[model samples]
Target: MERYMSLLSPGDQPPALLGHEDIQAKLRKWITRRASGSEVSNSALIISLWGTEGAGKKTQLAHLGHYFNEPMLFVDMTKVPEEEREGPDALDNVFREAAIQQALPVLCGFLLQEDSEAMRNRKRELLDRLKTMSGIVFVLSEQPCQPIDLRSRIDLELEIPPLEGEKRSDAWRTLAAAYEVDESVDWGILASRFVFSPGQMSNAMRTARTLSEWRQEEGKSGPIRWSDMVEACYKQLNHHLDAKAKRLTPKKRWEDLVLPEAQTKKLRHACNHIQYKHTVYGLWGFDKKLSYGTGVSLLFSGPPGTGKTMAAEVVAKELDMEIYKIDLSQIISKYIGETEKNLREIFDEAEKSCAILFFDEADALFGKRSEVKDSHDKNANTEVAFLLQKIEEYGEYRLWRRTICKT
Candidate 1:
């Protein structure tokens, strides 16, 4: 073990993978099969690496480049000028440059926000050329474009999930060891509370260290404070949740909460469900019993300032996630069918975020229904019923840490 650790030293070799064993193995196998004449997985060479913004596509590609001892060409498609991105010749030139540079595993990022068929077709052209000329190709997108963008030509599709459980812990440990920070830092707490990707964690460490250094004089080498790490982790995930809802940093704890003991206990248990649902449902084989509604959806009923919002924040803080108060004005619509559409957009975003979804003023959505005598009444009932069904069905998509906080 000591010898292996020594070999892992950055001086001896490039950075160790730490947690991406499966990705490394698949990437290496594909590179080998593509290089050699050996029959491969349907002779497919185009691989798509996609996830959220900071889910570590570029970093993973770097690791793959290091593993294969090859140069990588990273192209952020968003940076491609609007005129250049629209034209086929621009992309064609970029591919010619990558080939001339003898770059392997070209990483290109495409944002669905600027989604255009011309852009997608240009990407397709590059992908086909790369498969024939380059070592491998990686297409990164904000959404799941594996089937649509890459189509059936995907030799390997690596969707880099946000680091959770042991992977998160491994990331903390790996960066901590590299930084040589105090070993006493609570990595388990960080792992539990932050749904950071490997790249985000790397940025968090750098930010933490810089903050620590700025707080003290040089050569003193003060420890990276726990608060610094917490703040840094929070900042890394700040940009995504702003449009849909406001992000909260809970200054309150269970001690600060003033709810009745029974209610508090129920809230605590619900938070636990968010933290360890995978263990109870998957490891203990409890998932075999029931199908839908594995997520904990509870109604926190009380008057205003009854600690409902704070409890949501506490759960998010305790579980190392962000809390977003869904904007009710945008969600609850007067127009028919638009309510469901808005709710779907919010839920869809929340599913990816894995944050505590605090739907405040939710009584507006869930009200006592009378006999449906009119179209308005029927539409209201339908909207309420649709939300309930979607909330119940969120569990089918592996939302282990997604807690639905209703107020």
Candidate 2:
């Protein structure tokens, strides 16, 4: 308890001692708040740091965390659970995590409290402060942020600028100290060969150290070579990038496609449009911007097993995106207006990863509108109109529409 008390003190912190020229302003601001007796505010603290590989963000964060003395929670946004993803309300998921950390527990605590009205109101006020107390420092590696609500919440954004000339020299010096490499090794030559993040650099150093000890135990006298460091860093970088791609596990490949030659060519062309990023809608004259018209819509009017779904998978694989086959039977409901809600969620979730929306039984949903005979008919027509609107707005992507005798 005594050790924890020093965390709240207004003394000069470790970050202020760092000789790095760029971090001085941030350091001053942090110390000034502490001196003023104000709790370090986390309300508007959305700091986003980004840069090319080996720009040294993780190193900077380590220094800053030591200065703050508060636990810095580095959330890898790229690794969100599937259930927390976009299907229903993603905002709810954010709230759920926040609540788990007692970020807004005071609100719930009031209901459970057996105190009188006056005491309960005072407790409620204390809870208000709790909402602002659980500050976060989330670090997203390379995750694609699709939902607007999620993007809007991020506050302060900083990128680790690309190192050149003297900055590169300084980075190498830092690496040397942390790595404990031989003085004979050429820093300039070694720095030029590798593209690594601070996290990768540290891991590589730790790995080299471990390897060196193992070799020493075997009575070997060779220094840790640059080749070994490169191989280790390469493996770590590959693992990180591959994990990002794994979020959307590809189900099928191009070979699984078994459509007619003509249909296959058209499907392949559509995939090319997405892959090469061809601007067919913009007539290819303009730079690859989508024209502001009805999006590239296509109708795959054919029998089942003719490779409509398989073609969709090829498009997903080519573009490096996800494919979500919509089960219309489950989505389409007997209750009025519920069908539209389900359809909206389907489109919304599909839009997050720019997923290929494969409506398996196309004719069932895209059937011709019936006459205005009864309430059920009118409701059914309304659902059809909504689906048509969503499909139209669903931009240039592989949309497979399977059919059977045209209903």
Candidate 3:
């Protein structure tokens, strides 16, 4: 029980919080108000920080502790036993620890798994306990609390947005400087190519350092190079996408893609959409105008053995990104809602890896909707709708190949 909790004293120096100046400012202002004894609520001030994993929620919590200028009790709720989790016993222990140490309680890992009556009751109880508490409390989650019961109780809910573009480049440079990485290593190129979270960037740098050390052990002595960092970043992304899609090494180049000049020009333009998206979208203010359909989605429709698959590889190689051939058999499911679940997983993994999704035989999934005569037909249409939504929502490149049979 004690192992699940740790005290983060004010003297303990955590890593610097990066790329969330707005969030940091809000947190500091909130803490300053509290410190000045300007109380708005009699109950505990619960600040909920929610975002994608590795988006630095814990880092924000640590920074929050620093702003509070007091000892903070860090509770990892995931480590608590399931039977005791959300129970009075666990709550009692947590409050007891915080009270004994005179520390602010920072609880993380509050994932709402289900919406059953029992779960609702447990959440209500938790809310009641939190509202009665008399100090500042922090809740960190990968997602915002969906339940109105819990959401209404939260005093402040700030989303820690993922680092992108310049922010990402800055994070790369900052971490490199902290880790004493080779200054010659081109972080800007790496940042542009990889849509990595700050946490991922840190992991990649550590892995790159390890690779450099391994080379030294084999009698090659040098600092971490660009190639080593690239390899390390790919290593961090490799495991998540393998289960859903088959990773393809893009061996095809533009010269190998034998198509008409007009068709070839269109393909190049499609590649440019991805290549210079930051310029067009970010720099030119197009991102503010469009809400959806920002991702580069290409539908390659042609007869069999006519280079649809080869074209996808060529585009991937042109962009210097890994391509994953999505396995239709693995994604499409017989059970209702299961297909959407699988698609969400695939898209999420693709986003993390920054890989091009190549869907071969894509018509099998994206075909015209049939008449709504049966339950199966409705489910099929639902799946298609969900797939289209995911494709539109995807921020990177997605290539789909449809085979047309010619009589």
Q: Show model 3 residue runs off by greater than 4 Å.
A: 38-42, 81-90, 111-114, 179-195, 212-231, 237-244, 254-266, 299-307, 326-353, 362-391, 402-407
Segments of candidate 1 deviating more than 4 angstroms: 1-13, 38-69, 73-107, 110-164, 180-189, 214-222, 238-260, 271-295, 302-331, 345-355, 393-407
lDDT of 3 at 85: 64
- For all candidates in order, the CA lDDT equals 0.64, 0.50, 0.81
Q: Which lDDT tens digits does candidate 1 get at residues 106-128?
A: 44555422447765666566555
Model 2 is weakest, by summed lDDT over 10 consecutive residues, at 104-113
- Which of 2 and 3 is the better model by TM-score? 3
Residue 84, model 1: Cα distance from true site in angstroms? 7.7
Better of 2 and 3 by lDDT: 3
Top model number, lDDT: 3
lDDT score, candidate 3, position 389: 88
**Against the hidden reference, what TM-scores do the models get?**
0.68, 0.41, 0.78
Candidate 3 per-residue lDDT, tens place, 256-306, comes to 989999989999999877777767666576867888777788889999999
Q: What is candidate 2's lDDT per residue for 28-128, written digit by digit as tens? A: 36544654555555452434454554455544655555555433333332354445433334324444444454331111101212356664443344333
How should the candidates be ordered by TM-score, best one leading?
3, 1, 2
Q: Which number leads on TM-score?
A: 3
